[model samples]
Target: MGLLCYGSVGGVMASLILVFSVMWVGGVGGVGFHERGSVMKWSGIPTALSLFAFCYSGHSVYPTIYASMADKTKFSRVLFVSFAVCTINYGVMAVVGYLMFGQATKSQVTLNLPVENMSSKIAIYTTLINPLAKYALIITPLVNAIEEWLQVSKSRFIGILIRTVILISTVIIALTVPYFGYVVALTGSFLSSSATMVLPSLCYLKIFKSSRRWGLELVMILAILVVGVFIAVIGTYVSMKQIVSSL
Candidate 1:
C-alpha cells in the first residue's frame, strides 16, 4: 500500500496501523506471571543480545531514508526521534506481552493470541497483510541497486525479472529455514551487529579524525567495536549451533 500510495504518506499510515494494532494487544488484558516459570537465567544472554541487535537493525536503510529527507542535516534528529519511538513501542509491547504470556510467549507474539477470538483473528490477518503492504517499500532499494549495477534501469522487463528472482530467492530461503526465531537470531547476530553497532562507531572515529588521538572518545568507540565484534562472533556461533540441532 505504501508503494502504491505516496511513500511518505504511506509510511505514516503503516505506522499508524501498527500503533492501533498494538493497542489491541495491551487492551486485551493479561494474566500476570504469577505461578509462572523462572523469569531469568544465564542461558538467555545470546538470545537477548540477538533481539537487541534486531531492534536496532534499521541502520541498513538509514542511507536511503537520508537521501529522501528534505533536510539532510536534520537526519540525525529524525533518526533519534525514530529510535525513541521504536524504543517506547518495543518496551510497551515487551511488558504487555510478557505479562500476557509469560514463559510461554511465542517467537511472534501474535501466535500467542487465541485464534478463535475475533480480535485475534483481526490481528492475525492484519499482521499477515502488513508485511505484504511494506514488501515493495522494503525491496525497492535492493531492486534499484541491482538494476543500477546491471545498467537495466530503463528496461521494465529486466526490472520485473530482477524483482521476481529476488522475491523467489527470498521465499526459498524462508521455506528452507522455516524457523522464525532462528532466522531472526541468525540475521541479527551475523549482520546487524556490524550495521547497528560496529560500523557507526568506526565511521564516527574516521569522520572526526581531527579529534585528539588516544582520547576517551576514541577508547569508547574502540570498545564499542570490540564488543560488537564479540557479540557477533558469539551470537552467530550460538545461532548456528541451534540451527544445526534443529535440523
Candidate 2:
C-alpha cells in the first residue's frame, strides 16, 4: 500500500512535469499551447460533469479507509487533505492539458503527447502504471463483499479465483468496448455521483432525523441531493445517447 501510494504520487508529478515541458518544447511532434478554445460549449457540459464526478470516485472505498483509521476524529481532516491534494493535482493537470493541446486534445491526454520526447514517454509509462497500481485498492471492497456473499471469505483459493475472474472480466470488457469514454461517463454519472453525493446525503439525513429539524443544514443537504440527481440523470442520458448513436 505504501509503495503504491509513493509510486502513484511520483507518476502524477512526472506527468505534470512532462505536460508543463510540452508548453516550451513545441513542434517536436505535437501541438503547442497556441490554439484558442471556445469560451464554453454547452453541448459538452453533461459529459464534462460526468467526467468531473469521476474524479471523486473514491467514495466507495472511503468508508473502509475511515474505519481503518486509528484516529477516528481526524477522518474529516484526512478526507479534506486528500480531496484538496487530489483536486489541485487534477485541476493542474486539466488546465495544463488544455493549454498544451487545446482543440487537438483527445480524451486521453497521453495520446496528444509528443511521441518522440523522453518526457512524454516517461509520462505515458507512469500514467499506465499509476492506474494499475490503484485498481486493486479501488476494487478491494467490492471483491471482499463478493467473497462474503458467496460464503468464500475464508477460502483462500476461492478468493483468489474470484479476484482473478473479476480482473479477467474487466480486462475483456475494456478491450471489447471502443467507447470507453462513454462508459466512464456512465460510471461516473450513475455510480460515483450516487456514492459521493446522493448516498452520503441520504445517510446523513436518515441517521440524524431524530435530532434534526427543518433548518438550513437540512435545506443544504436536500439541495445537494437534487443536484446529484440532476447530474446523474442528465449525464447518464447524454452519455448513453452518444454511445447508442455511435454504435
Candidate 3:
C-alpha cells in the first residue's frame, strides 16, 4: 500500500494488472447471448445510477494530486490521462461484464467470472489489491479535513489517531450495514453525488460570481447541478426503500 501510494511505478503496474486481469476474463469466455441479456429491469435504475456516480467520485483527491505534482502546469494533462485510463478501465469492465452476465452481473465483476477459471482468480486477487493500493489516496484528504477542522496541526500523531478512529468507525458501519448494495447506493446517492457533482458546481459559481457568472459555463454547470440533484433524490429514495423493505 505504501509503495503504491508513494511511487508512480507501483500505481502504473497495479493499474495494468487490473486492466489485463479484467480483459483476460473476457477473452477466455464465449458467453452465450442468454448471458448478454436483452432486457433491463426498471427497478435497478437507481442502483445503477448511484453506482456510476460512485465510480467517478474521485474529486476529493484531486487537490492532493495537484499539489504534489512537480509540474503544476501539467495538472490538466494528468487529469486528462487519469480520466482516460479510468474511462477505458470502466468501459471495458462494464462491456465485458455485461457481455458475460448482463443483468445478473455482480458489483464485483470477479464474482461474475467463472470460479474455475484462472482468469477469475487473477481478477479477484487484483480487486483485493486495488482498494489497498488506493487506501492512502482515499484517506489522506479526509484526514486532512478532520485535522483542519480541529486545528490540530502540531502533532502527526494526532493525524494518525484521527485516521485510526475513522477506520474503526468505518469498520463498525460495515458490520452494521447488513447489505453492501444498500451501503453503496446510499453513499453514492447522498455523499458521492453531493461531493462530486453538486458541491463543485456550486463552489465554482460562488467563487467566480464577479467573473463569468452568466456565461456558457454557467449554463453547463446548472445543467449538471440539476441532473446531479435528480439522481441524488431518486437514488436515495430507492436505496432507502430497499433497505427498509429488507428490514
Best model per lDDT: 2
**Candidate 3 whole-model C-alpha lDDT, 0 to 1:** 0.77
- Candidate 2 lDDT, tens digit per residue, 1-247? 4444565466556545655555444444455556678879899988888988988778767777776667789989988987887787778767777877786778787887777887677667766776675777677788988998998999999999999999999899888988777889888898889988999898998898752587788889989899789879999999899899989
Stretches of candidate 2 exceeding 4 Å from the true structure? 1-31, 210-212
- lDDT of model 1, residue 212: 35
For candidate 1, report its TM-score.
0.84
Clashing residue pairs in candidate 2 are: none
Taking every candidate in turn, the Cα RMSD to the unseen true structure, in Å, is 3.1, 2.7, 2.8
lDDT of each: 0.73, 0.78, 0.77
Tell me the deviation in Å of residue 215 in model 2: 2.7
> What is the Å distance of residue 28 in model 2 from its true position?
9.6
Cα-based lDDT at residue 36, candidate 2: 70
Point to the candidate with the largest TM-score: 2
Cα lDDT, model 2, residue 218 = 80
Candidate 3: stretches off by over 4 Å: 1-4, 7-12, 29-34, 39-43, 210-215
State the displacement of the C-alpha of residue 111, model 2, in Å, after optimal TM-score superposition: 0.7
TM-score of each: 0.84, 0.87, 0.86
Ranking of models by TM-score: 2, 3, 1
The worst-scoring run of ten residues by lDDT in candidate 1 lies at: 28-37
